[model samples]
Target: MGGAFLAAAVLARLGGRIGLPTIPLFILAGILLGPHTPGVVLLSDPHDLEMLSALGLVLLLFYLGLEFHIDDLKAGGRKMAVAGGTYLALNVGAGLGFGFALGWGTSEALVLAGVLGISSSAIVTKVLVDTGRLGNPETKPILGIIVVEDIFLALYLAALQPILSGADSLSAAVMDGGKAFGFLLLLALAARFGTRVVGKLFNTKDDELLVISFLGAAVFVAGVSEWFGVADAIGAFMVGLMLGSTSSGARILKLVHPLRDAFGAIFFFGFGLSIDPGDLPSVVWPVLAAVAVTLVMNVLAGLGAARVYGFGAGPAANIATTLLARGEFALILATMAAGAGLDERLSPFIAGYVLVLAVLGPLAAGRSAWLARVLPGGAGVCAGRGAGRGGGLTFRRRVRVRGGWSRSSPRPWVVVRLRAGGRFSRSSPRP
Candidate 1:
């Protein structure tokens, strides 16, 4: 385990240098270290790695739930609903259609749809921040759509367990599905109305107590959720939603971030250990096609979502391009399928797909402004009002740091600058 962690950290650093996202890199490291490879680093049993990975999923979803708001649609209004609904419908439908065409069963197709349909929050956020578009106008709809996706995914995952497990028969699956849905509906109600009760119940100034209390609640709820067939990750997610609404949510989120990163890296790495490298080549073409299709749909979905919310062509295109990367949720589906003994091909197929997209999707985001200009409306965030090739935003003012503006720089710091010809370029933020 120690060796695996060290290798993962080193590889992650190198991957970052090359602009590959962290989660995919963790999987790549696992693949390299896996038994199927040269065996430089030995990966442990698939079952054991999966156990650890399960914990990671629980924490990951819990953290997201804590950050998510169930009543968010009320705040973002009809735009949020319209954008999120259309985006999900289009992407998920694409995924399901693609999956069925690949000859997988209905259950397998549903999991595949989930893996392809959702975007990676971590990757998209990084792209936005790196490109200095974190505060851009289109960012709002992008985030709104993400929230919508999260809620839908939570419901989907809850029901997926029974379908995949295949305990008794179709009727048994329906019963299990009902259990999951009922649990989720109750959890949602708690999120909506139980914030004050929880806030008052768990009030504590001591950081240790706060952390213990929060983790305990998350674990307990997750266990109960799983026992009732709602699934542990979904249960943990509901706990997060419930806790996230309180006054102490921010502090809890801050404290839990380190754990989230550490466990999340392990979770992604464990997923890699499940696949054999030799299997990848057989599935590469289909996975690549899926990646390409999803990328196009990502732009179209983003554009359509933004348009529904009254954003212009530029912002619409920007939204479409920015929402392309798929990460954690995709991994969760792959991991669950692996545990359930589904088609052997599904695991490696998704692993390869995610690995490719985690890198390719972000690069595409960089070109979204350009792609939008090429589309029918032919307008994009980087583009301008007239015809022909459109222009992107560029910074003209002298760079500013903590205090005042600087004409030049002394040493160096991580500085992000937006340009007309491109989405982001590097510049010093010197005082």
Candidate 2:
């Protein structure tokens, strides 16, 4: 076991140095050393590793929420809603069509649709951040759309489990959905109450206590959601939405970040630990096809949705192109599939598919500016020509302005003050 882990770590580090995505390499290593692979059995069961995967997801979602601010959602308003809705509809439709053509059972088809409906927000967001484009005029709008999409992804995943698990019929599914809605309503109310209670409770402002309460709120919400049969990611997002509306969220996020990172790293590593190396050849072609189709369709769909939201062609294109990759969501879908008794054959395919996307997605999106320029505003080129030149010269100019007014240059309001003071002190000339 120790040797397997060591090998996995070394391979992952080497893969990263070579610009390959470490996560996929990690998964591959696990498979290679796993029971199905050549003569080595490191991990016999995925259950323990899966727990860590779950922790990774929980923390991943939690941090995603931390990064989100309700103000951003409110600010983006129409763009977020319209783009998110359209993208979800189109991608899910495409997935369902493909699944049906593939002759998957109805339940399997539905799960497949859900899986393809969502993109890897983690991967996309990470790409944006890594490229220093997170707040770029082109990227911010895309990020907003992605944030809204994550919420939808959360809800979609919540709805999917019941259908796939065979735990609910149509009527039962409806009831379960209603129950989720009711719980969310309660959560909303609690969030509202929090706005009032939190302010009063922490009036003295102990940072440690504040951090505890903040995390407690998130974990409590996650637990409640799980108890109610909704996914825990949904719970974490709701917690983010609630705290984000309050003033303390930023500080809370800062406090919990170290823990979130440590756990998140383990989570990804755990994901790799479960891949069965032996199954690769069997599902390779189908998984590759699915991944290719999904990558192309999602990017186009995101672009179209962005256009619908009134983003120019360039930005819309960039946003759409950026969203084409998959990451954590794919794993979640795979996990759900496992619980639902879907074919074990599908897991590796999904993992490999996600792995490919994470690496390729960024490289593709990095070219969005080139795509944007070629398309003439199809991808949200907010700046005019030369705007791409280090954020244009205007922003640099603004930053260079010196502090404090020159004595020779009185404040612009000085004239009005002098006029009000009336008639002239010769020492202070009127404008």
Candidate 3:
């Protein structure tokens, strides 16, 4: 554990100097020092850091939930659904086709569909924070899309379990899906109606007690969620969502920062330790093809989302590239594939595919301006005009006075009015 932290810190610091994101750097550090490589093995077994890594993932999602308020969820519910649906349809559909083309069995294709379909919430959150784009106009949709994917993941896993287990009973799969869906609904209800009670439960003057209280709640709920077949990360996120509406939300946000960062690095590092560079060569072509498909699909999805929100090229590029990576969930699927005696090739294919995008996603997002330059329309068009979802149109008003608007007051008085769902604000002029 100590070695993992030290190596991650060192590599991340070095990568920082070169303007690289810390996520891939942390993973690289694990790869270099792990047993797979023939040099100075810090941790021979990746499983040694399993608990810490899980904690890292939990903290990362929990922090994301804290930042993502329930009001934001309600505000862009419809747009989020559309954007997320588009993303999944393009990527998952492509993946299914690709998987069948590989001559893999039906089960393999199903696994591949999910592996390619969903974006990495952990990596996406880290990128948004690392790039300082948390406050950007497009981030709301990005976060909303992630929320949608998390919900979809529950159902996806439930459906996949029976197939992997080789169980012929459709009823079993439905039962499992019901369990996961029911658990999520329970959590949502708690987040919606139980905030006051949760707030009181964790109301403590001391930072020490507060930390313990929130941590316990998050981890406990996450574990329970896993028991009910939902992803633990989603559970942690729900806990954060519930607490975020409370008065202590700000305090929890402040306190959880260092912990989240520290454990997050460990999570990526442990991820690296599990991967063997030797396994990548066999699946190189498939991985490259998957990456290409992913990039194209993401770009299309980004443009589609941008069109929906009436954003110009730059925001569209950011939306596409920001949600490009596939991480933890893909690996989880790989592990399940291996355990269920599916195709042997699935694991390595997923690993190589994940590693390439994991590194590429942040780099592309950081340089999204380059992509924006190549995309049609001006980069700054409709920039900062309105929040995502209902307010895509911007209205400009010019109070022309004497002398035909003199040079002293040349620019138009921009009274950016929002016309959402065909309903204009009552305060705005009727024009």
Candidate 4:
């Protein structure tokens, strides 16, 4: 455990200097120090970190829930639905088609649909924070889309489990799906109406007690959610939503930051530990093809979201690339497939596909300016009509002043329109 933390921290620190996102770096550290690699194997079995990884996932989602305000959900309800629906339709449809094209069994195709369709919530949240886009306008939609995906994941898992188990009747799958959906509805009601009760339960003055309280609630709910056929992440997120509505939400947010960061790193590192590099080669072509398909679909989804929200090319590119990675959920699906006696190839194909995208997603999101330039509207397009709604690249010119023209500051041309009602802005002229 100590070695895992040190390895992840060292690699992430080094990667940060080179302008790389920490997620893939953490994962890379795991891969290098894991049993699959030749030198310096810190842990031979990935399962050693399983509980820690799960905690990491829970904390990440809990933090995301804390940050996501209910008002945003109410305000952009329709837009989020539209954006998320578009994303799912495009990606899930493409995944199903690709799966069938592979001539794999129907069960394998079903599994692949989920693996390829869903984005990694953990990766997406980390990307937004790392890139400082958590406060951006498009982030609302991105997070909203993730919420929609989590709901879909519940139903998808319920349905898939029955199929994988070789149940004779479709009624079993339907029953399971209904149960999951019902559980979600119950949780939603709690989030909507149980905030006051929850707040009182957790409203102690001491930070230590507060931390223990929320952590216990999040982990307990997450575990219970899995028992009810919903994703544990969703359970944690719901807990976040409830707690975020309370008066202590801000304090909780500040306190949980370090915990979230630490565990989140362990989560990705544990993911890296599970993968065997030798298994990736046989599925290389399929993985590449899946990656290509995911890229194209994400771009289209981003453009569609931009159009719906009246955003410009820059925000559109950010939305597309930021949500491009596939991680935890894909791994879960791979595990299910392996257990169900599906095609032997599904596991490797998923591993390779996820590894490539997990590394590529952050790199692309950070450099979205390139994609923005190539988009339909140039990068110079106005991001939003009003001040705080959206933001984009703004060009400034050197103006002649009383002193016979003030010297143009270095990189004076471009500025980033922030989300603080356009009250504050930053210059980032670099491409």
Q: Residue 320 CA error for candidate 3 (Å)?
A: 0.8
What is the C-alpha lDDT profile of model 4 across 1-431, one tens digit per residue? 99999999999999889877899999999999999989999998899999999999999999999988877877898999999999999999999999999999888888989988999999998888777777777889999999999999999998888789888778888888888899889998898889999989999999999999999999999999998889999999999988998999999999999999999999999999988899999999999999999999999999999999988877788889989999999999999999999999999999999999999998888777778777888546443322122334564444332343233644234444445232445465342
Predict model 4's lDDT versus the native: 0.87
Top candidate (lDDT): 4
Which is the winner by lDDT between candidate 2 and candidate 4? Answer: 4
lDDT of 1 by residue, 96-152 (tens): 999999997788899988988888765565456445564465666776787667667
Extract clashing residue pairs from model 1: 66-240, 302-320, 314-380, 382-391, 382-392, 392-420, 393-419, 393-420, 394-420
Segments in model 3 whose C-alpha atoms lie over 4 Å from true places: 378-431
- The models' CA-based lDDT, in order, is 0.71, 0.61, 0.86, 0.87
Candidate number with the higher TM-score (1 or 4):
4
Write model 3 residue lDDT over 1-431, tens digit each, in one string: 88888888988889889878888998899899999999799988889999998999999999999988888877888998998888889988998998998988899999999999999988998988887666676888898888788888999999998889989999988998999999999998899889999899888889999999999989999999999999999999999999999989999999999999999999999999988999999999999999999999999999998988777786788899989999999999999999999989999999999999999998887777667666777444354322232334454445344444233465556354443223334344422
State candidate 2's TM-score.
0.74
- Which 10 residues in a row give candidate 3 its minimum summed lDDT? 384-393
Q: Give RMSD (Å) of candidate 2 vs. truth.
A: 9.5
Cα deviation of 410, candidate 4, in Å: 33
Clashes of 4: 0
Better by TM-score, candidate 4 or 2: 4
For model 4, where is the 10-residue window of minimal lDDT? 383-392
